[model samples]
Target: MTVPASTAPPQDEVSPDALQAATTPQSPARRRGADTRALTQVLFGQLKELEPGTPEHSRVRAALIEANLPLVRYAAARFRSRNEPMEDVVQVGTIGLI
Candidate 1:
């Protein structure tokens, strides 16, 4: 299942501070959209260096998971209904992401 890319902000909307925040290796919990794009790039770059099955590889993979979690949530929200709990949907989406 493909998650839509609507979580990211348009390139023109990114501010200087947001760009700076994205470049640095830090938690991007507060900044959405543009920041998530930047973090994704950084994480992908790091992923290239680490071999699979290693601890460092797993760490970077986890970072990728966290970075794209909002996407999972956004996708899961679409399926939420009286019968389906949001938490279960999110968990399943997260698993799909992994």
Candidate 2:
């Protein structure tokens, strides 16, 4: 799922083929449902150290947020009947994760 940054041509090169792919809306990858729970528990278990503000700590926090995004989306979906947009709701929920 990792797209290589180096694979992108420089801005000055502007090829039509590349532009099409770049503008296309890619479907999100399927989330790891069952494994997410165990993975989240393991990551939380490793947070025993006192350095909560460190880069490693940030990465773990980011991983936890990414791992549980589906839950946030689900929670956001409950508010779909309201006037707010789903995307905005999901975004707010995502920030709440941190």
Candidate 3:
């Protein structure tokens, strides 16, 4: 999962929210058994050349983008089961990525 940058403590200070976050119990089953390989291929296929990349290689960016999507699907699926509408779920997930 992506950590929120704003929550990270600076070199000499800490925050209550960050401390509470550390103690939070995360879900073990990330999703109802997602097909990570398939998801990665799908995400990678959907991406364009986005940029020349830091060193002109596409694989690095593709991997980075792919790595985050299964979690997106998982969060989306959970919202879906919790009564969120399908279109809304996808929109929320997209917003999460942004």
Taking the tens digit of each residue's C-alpha lDDT, what string does model 1 give over 1-98? 76568975555778989999888875465457778889999999999999999999999999999889989998998886658889999999999999
- Which 10-residue window in model 1 sums to the lowest lDDT? 25-34
lDDT digits (tens) for residues 38-81 of candidate 3: 66566565454445554534665556555776677767877755
**Candidate 1 residue 28 C-alpha distance from true site, Å:** 11
Q: What is the C-alpha lDDT of each candidate?
A: 0.87, 0.84, 0.64
User: What is the descending lDDT order?
Assistant: 1, 2, 3
Which residue pairs in model 1 clash with each other? Answer: none
Write down the TM-score of every candidate. Answer: 0.61, 0.60, 0.34
**Candidate 1 Cα RMSD after full superposition onto the native fold (Å):** 16.4
Residue 4 CA displacement from its true place in model 3, Å: 60
Model 3 segments beyond 4 Å from truth? Answer: 1-59, 81-83
TM-score of 2: 0.60
TM-score of 3: 0.34
lDDT of 1: 0.87
Which residue segments of model 1 deviate by more than 4 Å? 1-31
Candidate 2: residue pairs that collide: none
Candidate 2 local lDDT, 1-98, one digit each (tens): 87688996655878999899889866544335657888998889876663889988888888888889988988999999999999999999988997
Deviation (Å) of 31 in candidate 1: 5.4
